[model samples]
Target: MRLAGAIDIGGSSTKLGIVAEDGSIIRRDSVPTSLHGEPMVVVDAIVASLQPMLDAGGTEGKPVSGIGVSVAGFLNRDHSAMVHNANLPALHDFPLRQSLKERLGFDCRLEVDSNAAVVAEYQYGAGRGSARLLGVTMGTGLGGGVIIDGKLLRFTGECAGDLGHIIVDHKGRLCTCGARGCLEAMVNSASLSERAGGRAVREIITSAREGDQLAMTALAETGWWLGLGLASLSPIFSPDRIVVGGGIAAAGELILEATRASYRTHARPEFREKTQVVGSSFEGWEGIVGAASQFLNPIA
Candidate 1:
């Protein structure tokens, strides 16, 4: 079986795996991102850790076809390097593909983290049959990816242009990105915690399920904001499907219910009728699967 090396670089950790041409993960492992050090240091660590897997798989003899990378940042048009990442300052503007190729001697393919998630969903998750798909991730911040006609749509770093940055309240919480009422700022983990009186999101979710008022309020508010953001995008993209993923999404129906209520209030009738919002299938392993798949099938 022809194999490929894939890596998903995140804010806290990195996942590495070998993928078969058919999108199966033959083997996988993970490592800390070590973002405090230079960009090259992290790159070197990744290469070294995965070298044994590649060697054991006899990649050198047949040549592992491509090295696919999924990272949380904007990507250059050529898709060769990470143009910018607000959370990962060390990786900003790093020639990721060049460095990996020089050190590992393999072809490299790079994609934004959300893009990778969308690809995974389209190919193996909730978006399988959807013609037009939108992938929304609610992590520390919101990120989005759109796929139309089984292909990715690249726009000036914003096919949906920082969908999380959508303004829901002109006079609301200030965002880390220097904006007020951004969808992310209004509904992310921090906001949820603050709204629940400094309670952790996990605690909030547990409490809400256990019928706690404070937790329920925080989740409802967060979901409402998320839905408002989705409602705004619905008109523009008219996506047939919207897949929600990330840690916050684990709140399940609590979040979706609130979002649905808000969406019904704002989205156009046609959009409301057409779009189907659901949770992701792979969940945390999304980036891992998508990163591996990139090497096997570069098109998506």
Candidate 2:
């Protein structure tokens, strides 16, 4: 069976895994991320964490054909390294692709996190049959990607040009990307935490699942802004399906119901009926799945 190694580097954590050709994950784990801007430290940690899995199946042959990396930022012109990301400043301009290959002794390729998320959904999750798919991942920051007729919408910088940076409210909040009222700033984990009394995002999602009123309210508010943001994006992509993934989406319907309501309220009539918003089947691990797909189910 063919296999691939994958890594998804985020603002708060790094996810690594082994994946098979049919889109099934063989191993999955995560490590804490640092904000101290030490690029090599992060890469070293990832290499160490992934070594065991790679060696576990080594007796058979090359354990994995190669590794794919997903990073949250604007990639360099040649898709070499992440050059910009407000949430993950440590890896900015870091030679992530080369470093991984050197340390792990395997081919490595970089993919924008947003692109990875959409590719995962399109290939093996909620977006399998979609003619047009738009996937959004809400975490330390917001990111999105698009697919049309099974091809990536890579118009600029390896993705849909920072969908999170779009302005949804001109006077709402300041974004890490230095913009005022960016959709991400308004609907990100920080804003959600603010509404939930400063609790961590995982805690808020857990509390909401346990029927905590305040937690529910916080997610609802975040979902509202998220819906507005999706509605704002509706006209451009006009997707048949919109898949929501990431930490915040763990609330499932608690967040999606509200997001759907707000989206319907704001979206045009034709779009309201045609577009179907759904949650990702991969939960928070879609990026890793897509990253692995670079080897398992490559899409240009």
Candidate 3:
């Protein structure tokens, strides 16, 4: 069976896996994401973490045919390199595809993290059977991507998937991108924590589940903002399905209930009913599945 090595790089961690062309994850692991250091240092760390798995796979006669890397950053219009990112400072202007190829001596495909997430969902998760899917991941940060008729939508500098940067409040919280009231600024984990008076995101979810009124209220407010943002985006994309995932989504009904309520109140009635918002079944495996999926369906 043909195989591929897939790597998904996030702000805090990097998930690596060996996958079959059919999207099965044969093996998977993750390493801490190096944020403060030379670009090559982080690159070397990634190589070190995956070398053992790659070597083992080679000995098993399942040598990987290529490598696919998904990162949270902007890609040039040409999709040749990562342009910039707020969380991954070392990746700016970095030729990630070339660097990986040079180190591994194999073919490599690069993709934006959000784009990879959408592809994984559309092909294997809640987005299945939808002609148009919008994937939103709310975690340490908020990011999104669109898949139209099973095709990934990419644009110059990866601006298309920067839905988190959309301005929602004229005088809202400050964003890492140097903007105020951006979607991310309003609903990221950090923002949620702050809004909940310094409680961690995990704690908030726990408290809400246990019937803590304060935690539940805060989560609902955040979800309301998220729904409002999606309402603003709905007209532009007209997505048939919207899949929400990531850590914050663990709030479950606490968040989704508010989001659905806000959507009903703010969004156009015709469009609101047509677009179904649901949580992802991929859950904890989204990054792994997404990285692996890249090889099965390489960015084209």
Candidate 4:
């Protein structure tokens, strides 16, 4: 069986995996992303981590046919390089695809992380069978992607799914993007942590799971904001389903119920019953699985 090597580069960590054609991860590993270093430093580290997996043909004995990368940045028109990434400043304008090709000796595919994630969902997860799908991932920040009639939507800037920067509240909170009340600033991990009394998002989630009032309240508030953002976008896209994923989404219905409530309240009345908000099927590995699949069967 043929496989694809996958890499998902995020703000805090990078995930590396070898994936089979059916979206099963054959082997996986991760490394902390160096926030302050040359872009190639992190690249070298990823290459080192992936080398063994590539040579071994992975756990399923599948030879990798190519490589795919899901990155948290704006990809250029042809997806050859990262045009910009506020979280990983060092990678701005970096020729990531070329670099990886030279080091790994395989054809490489590159995609915005959120776009890759939605592709995974569309092909194998929650968005299956939907003609219009919108997928949102909330991690260190929020990301989104859209699929219309089974085709990935690509706009002029190639940033069509950058939902984090959408303004949810005009005077709400300061965002990393230097904006106030952006959806990301209102509902991202940082906001959750702050609401949970300086605790990490993971801790807050655990506390919420254990029925801690404060943690639950924080999650609810975050979900409210997230719903508002989704509601605002609903009229424009009218997605059949919206799948939410990320570390924070582990809170499950503690967050999703509130999001559904708010979306229903704010979205156009006609759209309220049309769209469904649910959790992702791939858990937190959607980006990796989707990236790998893009390498083997690319969307036209």
Top-scoring candidate (TM-score): 2
Clash pairs for candidate 1: 158-161
lDDT of 1 by residue, 180-259 (tens): 98888988778999999998777988999999998998999898888888998887778999998766888888788888
Candidate whose lDDT is highest: 2
* Deviation in Å, model 3, residue 178 alpha carbon: 1.7
Q: Once model 4 is optimally superposed onto the true structure by TM-score, how far is the C-alpha of residue 139 displaced, in angstroms?
A: 0.9
Pairs that clash in candidate 2:
none
What would the per-residue lDDT of candidate 3 be over residues 123-241, giving only the tens digit for each residue? 77788899988988887678888888767777646636689989999899999999899998899888889878899888999988899888888999999999999998899889999
Tell me how candidate 3 scores on lDDT.
0.81
RMSD of each: 3.0, 1.1, 2.1, 1.6
lDDT of 3 at 93: 83
Clashes of 2: 0
Model 2 lDDT, full chain set: 0.91
Estimate, for each residue in 1-300, the C-alpha lDDT of model 2 and write its tens digit. 899999999988999999888888889999988766589989988988998999986965758988989998889878779888889888888888888999999999899999999999999999899999999999999999999998998877778988998999889899988889999998888999999999999999899999999999999999999999999999999998999998889889999999999999999998899999999998799989999999888997
TM-score of each: 0.86, 0.98, 0.91, 0.96
- The order of the candidates by lDDT, greatest first, is 2, 4, 3, 1
Q: Please report the TM-score between candidate 3 and the true structure.
A: 0.91
Q: Which is the better candidate, 1 or 2, if ranked by TM-score? A: 2
